[model samples]
Target: MDAPRQDAWKDEEDLLLATTVLKHIREGKTQLEAFQEVAEQLHRTPAACGFRWNATVRKEYQKEIQDAKNSRKATRTIYSSSKSSDDTPMSLDAAISFLKEMKTKQFEDYGKENLETQLKKLNEDNEKLREELKQWEAAWNEMDKLVHWVREKRKSESGV
Candidate 1:
């Protein structure tokens, strides 16, 4: 009793939009800020731009958010290689090493956060793709039925 379906390309557009928004949100920006910026830039509504921030995406970025907060705090301790040499102050090598260590720590934390966010985004994308595939299959099936019905009707009318 339902009407036949037509070809629809919904997922492709959704993917493009989703990826763009996800990239922005992952770049250490707030969801609302990213959404608003992306939406305005892309000439889209905020709601349409926000579909990428689903539960799955939120869960993925949650850890990164915590890590970022932790990373911002001072974890470096200034140590002078020649402690007795107060006049000389900290050695250049020691200062360099300490700075490198701090940089390394910040990088590692950000890397982990970024990785988790990307993984979550990938999972959400996969889910959306699967849903789109299902919709396509259903639409194809409906179209096939309609075509067969039309063929049968034409043959019968032509006495074939």
Candidate 2:
């Protein structure tokens, strides 16, 4: 009646999970979305991922989380102060445009990060392929040498 062992999180997985959670927070999206995405990538349950993030990863990034919260609070204060002074709220169009701009910027930043990750993975794959090719080449050369040795032995045995 022993319990099964769970897989440990690697550094790369932890980094990705942390980044995804931070991105979702910046975008004002639910943590569930981040958890689901990380879970799918890491082949873990969303609940497990979420629990790990809250229990461990979140604490590690306390400064980052606090900074984001402070930045948001400052933005809200600025907006509130402006509204109070003007006695008028931001127009619907202006608010929508601002939101659209923020979304676009977030998307661009995310895309850049994704590209960098992909490039790193591709570079690693390329290095692995090169090593495999070198091994194959060495194997082929050894086989060729063996074939030549066998042919020479047969010729000498046949007196040719």
Q: What is the TM-score of each candidate against the true structure?
A: 0.38, 0.43
TM-score of 1: 0.38
lDDT per residue as tens, model 1, 22-93: 544333335666667757766767665666556234455566555543433321232423244345454454
Segments in model 2 whose C-alpha atoms lie over 4 Å from true places: 1-6, 72-160
Candidate 1: misplaced stretches above 4 Å? Answer: 1-103
lDDT of 2 by residue, 11-123 (tens): 78889999888766654457899999999999999999999998888999988877766754554455434355654565453455457767887899999999999999999
Candidate 1 Cα lDDT to native: 0.61
Query: RMSD of candidate 1 to the true fold?
Result: 29.0
Residue pairs in collision within model 1: none
RMSD of each: 29.0, 20.1
Best by lDDT: 2
What does the lDDT come to for candidate 2? 0.80
Following a full C-alpha superposition, what root-mean-square deviation does model 2 have from the true structure?
Answer: 20.1
